[model samples]
Target: MTDTTKPRIVITYCTQCQWLLRAGWMAQELLSTFGADIGEVALVPGTGGVFQIDCNDVVIWERQRDDGFPDVKTLKQRVRDQLEPGRDLGHIDRA
Candidate 1:
């Protein structure tokens, strides 16, 4: 994506696992933080323990590989790193 273009973030979660809430919550976090910095935050329903976050078609996080769901803070940082690498996430950026 170009500097003028807003990247798309897609969150794929396992519907069978009832992880939609988590995915939605992540979407909320991203939207709340990035706001106009991002174009879209989509929630894709998947299965088989799949919980992945994709930005501009690149897989940033995966549940099975990571071994667990990411907390909202961590996930937001991952997104900010992609969307705007130098952008600050306020309190979330602090350790």
Candidate 2:
């Protein structure tokens, strides 16, 4: 699938180490929900709680961090917005 563009999503957490795990969980959920391929996890040591999610050459959604864990609602919205167009993830077959 060299030519094929898989769905790529980046999940970020707050500078605090705790958010790393939390963000990872959210990223996993999104991966399972959309069955997207090419899932990516990025951690920003210094930033304003921002995470980026890129979906199959369709859209790039950024997630803002809060004091507590990230809300799933925001994630769902971003995914929906990106997948709305005909991006075609090609295949989400990953173990």
Candidate 3:
């Protein structure tokens, strides 16, 4: 198997949290934000309050560590920073 240059995003959310909708929504958010610049977005089932976002195996967000779920804009920004540093997230980039 081979990995592409574009980032592959993985969203692992806690089934215990009932976070499938949240994970799926985040996946859709990532896809819409990055468009063709990204390789793929996948959702994985997890437990123990786990809700993490990863790109190319690099962890972007962790719920317990970070303390909570990220806003869609924040998550997109994290992804942009890792996958496409030069990407302009437009209004979403403003801090």
Candidate 4:
């Protein structure tokens, strides 16, 4: 069951591309940074070179559309923007 009250981050990566580590790493980063701020971070397997990050069903980062994967700082910013617009991400917000 999912807690719809809080924000959910879904990371869909291409299974054929062997991007599980990448997706998992990103999930870890988000979890570590946001902590309890986010409800969950899900890793969904996909194919055809797909790599997307969705927050609460809103696509925030798409590998094809965004050109490539997002860096940690950018990912953090995007998540923060969606979940808590006014929240500061310390050094991440500085750069």
Candidate 5:
């Protein structure tokens, strides 16, 4: 079970675009980096070329608005920033 008190991450991807693998991979990456720091990483299916990542209820990454996908480092940084603004992700912060 997830801790509701912690932050939730939602990755919504376009099902029609076959972005499941991409979304799943991103979820895995977030989980790997955040571990128990995060509440849960959910893979939500969507359409219309949507690929977005949300931390809590805030939209962190939107494909259309951001103009394409984020690299793993940027994703991590964004998530870390949202969850804990002052928290340093070691190498991630440096890189």
Candidate 6:
């Protein structure tokens, strides 16, 4: 988490649903928001619900432990408001 070189993003998913879909959605959201800042976002299959985003390097974002994905809109707003722009999003730990 202290690593500044990695990409920072949160990916959430439904406990009963496939995490890949959730990760894909998260990638889409990031692409929509950050655009070129994020080079790419991908779902890593069968890796404990991990989503990998490729920008400067490969940054991994894990889904919430519990069921149900977080609202993308809310997450975007939170990152925009709470997190410093250009800083790694992975450094921010959610409750």
lDDT of each residue in 24-78, candidate 6, tens digit only = 7767876677665433343445444433332333222223432334566545544
> Candidate 4 on 36-57: residue-level lDDT in tens?
8778899999999999999999
Reference-based lDDT, residue 60, model 3 = 96
lDDT of 2: 0.52
Count of clashing residue pairs in every prediction: 0, 0, 0, 0, 0, 1
Candidates ranked, most accurate by lDDT first: 5, 4, 3, 1, 2, 6
TM agreement with the true structure for every prediction: 0.90, 0.51, 0.90, 0.94, 0.95, 0.44
Better candidate number, 5 or 6, judged by TM-score: 5
Identify the runs in model 6 with alpha carbons over 4 angstroms from their true place. Answer: 1-17, 47-67, 78-83, 86-95
* Clash-forming residue pairs, model 4: none
- The local distance difference test score of each candidate is 0.87, 0.52, 0.88, 0.93, 0.94, 0.48
Worst 10 residues of 6 by lDDT: 53-62
lDDT of 2 by residue, 1-95 (tens): 32245545555445644566666677767766666444443333435655454455443455542334445666555665675544433333222
Worst window of 10 by summed lDDT in candidate 1: 1-10
Residue lDDT tens for model 1, 1-95: 33437888999999999999989988998888888888888899998989999999987899888889888888888887877788878898887
Give candidate 3's error at residue 51 in angstroms: 0.4
Worst 10 residues of 3 by lDDT: 1-10
The C-alpha local distance difference test score for the whole of candidate 6 amounts to: 0.48
Residue pairs clashing in model 1 are: none
